[model samples]
Target: MVHSNRCGYTYIGESGRESCCYRETWDDRERCIWHEEIAADETKPVEQLERARAPPEVRDLNGETGPREILDGTDVRGTVFPDGMDLAGVSLRDTDMAEVGLRNATLTGASLADATLVDADLRGADLRGANCWEAELNDIHLGEATLEGADLRAADCSDAILRAANLEGANLEGAFFDRADLFDATLSRTRSYGAVFSEARANEGTELDERCVYDHNSDADATRQRRESGAVRSDGGQASDTTVAGSDIDPLTKAEATYQELESLCSENALLSRQSQYFVRRQDIHTEEHWREGNWSRWLRARLSRAVVLYGESPFRVLSVTVAIIVGSALLYPLGLLRVSATGQPLMYPSPTEPIALVSTLIDSLYFSVLTFTTMTFGLYSPVGAGKLLTMLETSAGIVLMALLVFVFGRRATR
Candidate 1:
């Protein structure tokens, strides 16, 4: 039997135990907004569970706007005397939660992945361990929210106000932080690889790792690796991972464009080395896309450029490639036509007819190769037959390599 004066919200556990916690009641009704029973004598929260489990359209049709339909002038959600509106542990995944007033709501352990929470007021909510991966958190007011261990990977949190939010150990990989206000946010040990913090306002109290970088790996694989290593959070909870199903819309192209804007952000911050690293990563992804499209010519070009100079990030590779070219050209010159400038007497490596030393002919070929590579013809040696064409090719290669070397050096020296 339940008391008629108090709120009668009954929570039935998986073990089938019906427990009714004491809550304040309305003066005219038997229950408060959170604990309001649809039926006069229904003790179990059967209708509440059914409403939560309903489909998206079904919930909309049944008015998923929450109990704000009833006026509580004395109190508002999120600012209650002791406890707030209890929506805790609700599975709101893939629901249209946009512009909803969940302020001060208790959403702990809620499955909100892929939910559109744009402009929702969730200020001061307890959202620990919530699966919000890939959720649209744009412009959401989560000020003072407790988000420890929350899965926010790939979530679009652009322009979201998360001031003073405790996001310790949250998985924020690939999450967009563009213009997001994270002032005084406690983000200790957060996995923020691939998260773009472009133009995000933060003070000294905001614990952000300056060394955070994008390593181009999936969030699930990273989480699984951490779990396999038996890692635990600061709150004495074991690290857990959740696999998100595909979203309704694939934003891969938008993500690529967003990274381009992030690249500019790095340049604005004078992080040239980081910018170069990001450029290489973007090119690698594009090259992979080309490979998937079966564009063999583009793939070959990308591979050759990467091998030659590592996309201009490695200058030593460029020098080594030039050295190899010089050596190969020198060895090939002896096999072609080589003649003295004063006389048309051809010099061959074997010297079958004349009895000239092999070493002398080889040295001459090496000298000519160096001169030909630099495009510096001293008129001491001449080339006929195939040697003329080989010298032309080597000269062109020298010109291209010298320009590339200059560009690489300038790019590295600036920042």
Candidate 2:
């Protein structure tokens, strides 16, 4: 058990255990025999873990202020209280109170700008309007705390627990939140430009401020869309409530909502194409039973979706595929698989009347390939008897490629 000399409270538990309500560590040698059993109880609730919680205490400079009098106090700007102290409403500007254990305290309007609060246990504390600018708050626990209107600009909150904290109207520009657990924290109207939220967990009711972009591969973009759309939450915990009753919701209403959801997902199809495809396929199947019947057709469609338009997300892939087909077909002509004619007469690779170079023959073949691929009747070149079969196949492929290219371009241009 650990005893506080300042507050007269006894904290009985093992050190560093989250289940212990006490912020300070327990010393076994100082513990009584009866308190040993309480220390071993791991199943104790975190809020109820403390057997005795001392009343709020203050350690003033003169040591004369009473607990009630400290509530209305303010001038403790730089006093060092090197212990577990709860000094609410105290103005501690430019204070160097590093590694302090002020858990669950209410420090509303306290000015702690330029303070050294590294590794502080500020869990469930209220620091409304606090000036913690440029403070080193690394690994601090502000979980479920309220820091509304706090000046946290340039503060390093790396690996901090800010889950469920209310930080409305806070100025957090250039603050670092790398790997911080901001799950369910509300940060509405907060200026967070250049703030690092790398690997930070934000969820429902977590309103991110402007210019707060995350990694390309992270769920931050999706979470932003969901939160801004008011459709989904970042936590993936629950869905938003609708005004209409479930029983009374018509199929048309459900369909419209689903369409909006699919549209939103499709808009971000570069990262959400699979999810968008699922919804699109479901909707397509419901409208036409034929879409659900053919396995080969669906398989072909899935492949086409990936290869042609890349699920309506990439135009580059479509262009690359089209170029490959045209070039591949053109190369086959130079290999003597198909014969070409320039004037409706049979033409060999080595010209009899004029000696054509290998490069010239290849260029003519490419020209013919482009015409054949586009199905254009320029009549500059014609395929010989057996070559007609290859020409017909090329023509069919050209038509399909043209249609797919148009579709891809349309999606790209609209997007």
Candidate 3:
């Protein structure tokens, strides 16, 4: 049996702490909207009712018989616009145009608060100064659209295609852009507080401000591309306006300056990925000799470390080197270059007499090579003659390898 509140909703689950009272707050005798007492006199706001009513047949903005409408300030709430419909400056507050075709629509300054535009085809639309608060724009295609100064608070734009879109000075607080295509889009000064951009592809020209906090698991490659390409300037403005006095700067020179600036900024901030990308770009653009002139030792060491340890990111490379060293030592041992001996006794040289003897000697040599390479001693075998020198070399290599492994693992842990 279920315990029912005055709203007729059930209180299910455990009786005490783990129960759910599916009803409105009980403070001040409040009841759910569906409760009979509340439903009797419930009435929607007049503005909402007016918005719920459908608009007249679409027409041109000039009051002509054309399909497009320049009905600026005209309320077209709840209207289903046809494909290629132009409703520039029209008010569409609380409209229910779900699955409507609005491709190439001119909805500039349109009010779309609490509207349902699910699956709307708004590609190439001009939505400058538009209001889309709490609107349902899921799967909307807004590629190449202009949304400058648009307000999109709490809007759900999941899977929206916004490639090359302009969202300058837009307020996008609490909006969702999951899997959205924002490649080359300009989001300068766009408020993105609590916004979700997981899996969104933004490249160079995708400007950002300090307020933006994306999902940590978002596409790192896209972020790096934006940073390296100078698409992600700190200020929410056009890249041309970044340097006040460089208005006449040539494109190549400006690009180079931006790269250097970003490189310096990223290095200071300890943004290693962006810094590495800039370093690589500098290497590619400059002459080989010129690029390698200054800090030659530092550059050489950095490159060598990356190759040997994969920038301290790969354990497989470490393992491969270890295996190669062991194999090389094993092969040398079997060539009669590593006879075993005791500290004060004669050396135990290999005798390739019978097939069994040769096989046993080879196996023993391989085992001894492995033990020496690992710097481990069982006291049962010791190196003689040239083997002593090899043992010392192998021990030193093993120590270095072990130290590198430790450093790599520690760096990875902190990262």
| lDDT of candidate 3 over 1-415, digit per residue (tens) | 3334433333211112232224432334434332213232333233432332225443333234221222111222223455555566554554556655567787776667667787777878889978676778888878888998787866888888888888876766557887777777877656454466656655555554322212222233244234222322121222323222333433334334334544554455455555555544443333233334686766676666655676666666777887788778766765545544554443343465567766776677678767877778675566666877887888788888878888877865674
The deviation in Å at residue 69 for candidate 1 is 25
| Estimated TM-score for each candidate | 0.52, 0.37, 0.40
Q: Give every collision pair in model 3.
A: 61-70, 189-236, 205-231
How would you encode candidate 1's per-residue C-alpha lDDT over 337-391 as one tens digit per residue? Answer: 7788898787667856645577777788888888887888798888889988888
TM-score of 1: 0.52
**What's the lDDT for candidate 3?**
0.57
The superposed Cα distance between candidate 1 and the true structure at residue 174, in angstroms, equals 8.6
Output candidate 2 Cα RMSD: 16.7
Worst 10 residues of 2 by lDDT: 66-75
Candidate No. with top lDDT: 1
Give residue 226's error in model 3 in angstroms.
18
Please provide, for model 2 over 35-91, each residue's C-alpha lDDT reduced to its tens digit, 9 standing for 90 to 100: 222321222222322223334342343234321211111112222333334444453
Q: How close is candidate 3 to the true structure, as a TM-score?
A: 0.40
